[model samples]
Target: MSPATSRGPKTPVDPNAPGPMLRYQSNLPKLPVPRLELTLQRYLQSVRPLLSDEDYHRTEQAVREFEAPGGLGQQLQQRLVARAKDPKIVNWMEDWWLDQAYMGYRDPVVVYVSYFFAFKEDKFRTVPAKRAAAITTAALEFKRQVVENTLEPEYAKGEPLCMDSYKYMFNNCRIPKKPSDVAGMYDPFKNTHIVAIRKNKFYIVETVHNGQQLSTNELEQQFQQVIDNAGHIPALPIGALTAENRDKWTEDREILLAAHPENKAVLEKIETASFVVCLDDSSPVDRDQLSRACWHGDGRNRFFDKPVQFIVFENGKAGFMGEHSCMDGTATCRLNEFVCDGLNRNKINHGSEQVRSGLPAPQQLQFQVNDKVEKAVAEAEQHFDELIGKYDLTVLAYQAFGKNLIKKFKCSPDAFAQMVIQLGYYKMFGVSRPTYESGQTRKFQRGRTETSRTVSNESVAFVKAMENPRLPNEVKVAAFRAATKSQGAYMSAAVNAHGVDRHLFGLKNCLRPNEPKPALFTDPAFAYSQHWFLSTSQLTSEHFAGYGWGPVVSDGFGVAYMIKNEALQFNVACLKDLVVGGKTYKNAAYHLKQCLEDAANELRDMLIADMPAQAKL
Candidate 1:
């Protein structure tokens, strides 16, 4: 097992345990710095598949020169290692990375940064009001657990992940600024209401009154009131202004707040609310519909700043939207799983109190808009619609087999699925190029993710062999094993913070103002390989019907997949289908589904053929 996956020391489960969330915080090892030579060597290996032989040779020479003793690369690596060892730096890369890769990135969050998850079908609460009520109650329950720090920490293979991200999962908002952005977390007790958006209008529904949480019935009634109050008349879509670029939104927000000082207080109330509940008018069925609904609805129906937004659709279908600044998918996935599972199993405390006569009715937040604000909202709506419309989304729920079958074949499920991705990409584009797979690095304090380079020579060979009709079954099976093994090794290295990308990134980050740019980074192959033709990540849960994000690049595909016991679900996204050099990326989801099914069947046949007759039978 990789250091990232190593099981934590077994401890007895005690409900009365003190600070269980922080039990392993002090002793957990700090993130490590790999040797510069290893990182350079791996860098060369990763880039070779994406470049011409001549270009690869030039890049390899550049890497060697960079790795020489007393070189700039050496100096930078040393600086990074020293930073890691600094007594005050909890995690060396956290601040720089969060700012550069996320906060400082001045893009629209809708089709760029935010992620979404479609919840599993809820059978009991078919009525939209009941579903919203139950969901709100469940969320409050989870919120209480989070506030009290009573929720059990999530584990992977029985190993505890850093639960630090959970602190930002509630009562948090991403505030826009001129050059960069900032996040704020408020006291959970003070944020006692949930913001509800309907027909582009905002409503504040108080969750706690008289020191008691409102019952599910009360919540349902409030939700119904909001819906009824929002009838057919559309209000100014001030929320859509948030879907603009951070810099742009910052300017517009200033204009908005200046229009009416009261708007400032309203904005804070929405941002500092415990969470948001978006009662969308659209009722969607199926994975694709639900994903599209949750991913980026009319944009008017969302406050993109809130970390967690539970989207309850008109048909009672629900999902979640996450602001990427505060936390990642895994952290929010745990929260979603808790909410959905608790509601489904009837494990949440649905308070028994009826609607008291003295409780205030839900209050609608009003925004005063002038011509400038009106134009800004229109522009934002147009951008949101066009950007989301240009992209295609499809969900591939392959129920034929899943991780159980892969394990029965004695292979790592993730590695096997990665090969499936490789084969699928090759089948579509006729080449195996640079690929990115996110490996979680939450084993360390404040750690996020490291890039695992998935495209290697072994993967290429496997894809070629799989595509060659004349190749023997045994030969193909051997190639498959080699490819999966290589993938597994790279993933382990990534999780251990020994991957090439972050180290190189750190080195680049450490360069002095007067220092010349490193030849290794300036090389053409460096940019080409990191272009990331296939940006992929996996967060598997039976509770999620679909989950995904936008592609990192315009020409690439963002493939987010979930591995279940009996099925594999993929949410493939890309910009408009393009035909470049007679290679098309249209209907990528369908093609990937076909390729995965084909590869799995071929692997099963080859493994069965290699087994002895009795064992096979």
Candidate 2:
């Protein structure tokens, strides 16, 4: 079965069971160790296209010498296998990966570690109060399922995936520190309130009263009260400081905390809340507008520490912002899908339309910001405006074809889309370079991700053939098939924890002090190839109008694509100053849009020629 197919849970599950989500948790497989020989072979295949012939020969020699029977590669592989087999270690790479890939890095989270979703507008509920109330009601239902441990586990290809990350879904915050960051999880039972931010003012709204969640009408009433009370009064914009770099923000946080003794209490309340609901004061119409609205409001209006923040606009549109430190996109994607699905299907309780009188009002949380904090907030807001302004986002809702057409030709939709990306980059740059695509390893316990190096010699050949006007359609089609097959094989290997990148990472980290660094690690091609020029991933959902994050490197493009039945959507982002071959990456959105349409059409035409004579006629 393809990785896209979901097999049912490994063990039979009872719908009424209390711990349904955990039924097969203990039985999940441990991450595997790839054979050293197979890894070296895959590594060579992946890196060949990125290097010159001479460099490729040198790298090949380095690999052969490193893989000798008594060499360092052999020794490190043994150590890695032994570590994986250690009785106490659930997954050998989890902690090290979490730190190096996410937390320990010191870039600003807005453009790097944070991701955003642009939600479809609610036509039925045009008022902000009504929309906010309904979304909160639906979100609380999801929280109840997770907190009660009754939510069904997710699966891919009929195999149960790890559910450990869901525990950090609610009531979690990523706290900043000097050299690193740490995550804290508040007990969901104790943190029953949601933090609502509007006009740079914070309010706490209790979801439960008299042993039941607030009715939708009551929640709306509370929201209305907050709007009326806050009354467009401008506060000091303390939340804006969060958009700064970690090291800078850490210092700013201290100043705010020392501004007043009560300021610390306010910070704690926002951090410990179950989740955040930002009632953005603007209305957005299209994908770009909605995405920017949800991505980040005026920096002053957001508290970025919470892992999940639901942003609802005045026009009743909503989306989510995720702090990407403690959890990966898969977990949050599932959470958002569940919440939106509940609302769509009416499975969530809308409660009575009648408002209950005399309920406790939402409490306003205020901080004391002195001159130092005031200046810092101004600087943060300025930086945020300048930073996000540099990013240009465009949505390619390609209506000509989608997964339906790709699957008709017996192709994986994801692999087909990936090829389109490669061809698109080659069209713009006249070269194939290192590309990064995220691969899930969640079949194992606490597994997060493995890099599925997307560039290969087959892919390069395919793109070159497609771009050459002298080539026949048959030749291009053959190259396309070969490239997709190569992609599928590597993806399968990655899902099984046999991919070369992570394995190499583990081996290098375990090297003994006396051992000399392997020549393979020091190769210029190794460094150049790992510097991804195109970082792409696919996470599709019907609930979102658009979703994506900024590029990982300055010169790279963050290409996040979603495949729906009738169309494909892409959210392409990059830095303002990024340029390649004298063309600015800022203009890549337009170029990519044209390239995707062209590639899809060109491939469709080629496939049509392969049909039987009668069918074609």
lDDT of each: 0.84, 0.84
Task: For each candidate in turn, give its C-alpha RMSD to the true structure in angstroms.
Answer: 2.7, 2.5
* Candidate 1 residue-wise lDDT, 215-266, digit = tens: 9989988899999999988788888988998998999899888888788899
lDDT of 2 by residue, 1-617 (tens): 12323554555544454597777777788888889899989999899989899999999998988899999889999999999999899999988887888778777788777888777766777888888888889888888888998887887777778888888888888777888778878899988999998888999999888777899899999888877877877677877887888888888889989899999889989888999988878878888788777777677778887889998887888899999887888888888887787787778888888877768899999888788888889898888888888876667777777777777777899998899889888887889989999899998889888889888889999999998999887898899999999999899989888898898889888898988989988878778767878888888888788888888877788888988787888777776567775776657766776787777777778877865566544
Per-model TM values vs. the true structure:
0.95, 0.95
lDDT of 1: 0.84
* Ten residues in sequence with the least summed lDDT for candidate 2: 1-10
Clashes of 1: 0
Model 1 TM-score?
0.95
Once fitted onto the true fold, the runs of candidate 1 whose alpha carbons sit more than 4 angstroms away are 1-18, 579-589, 608-617
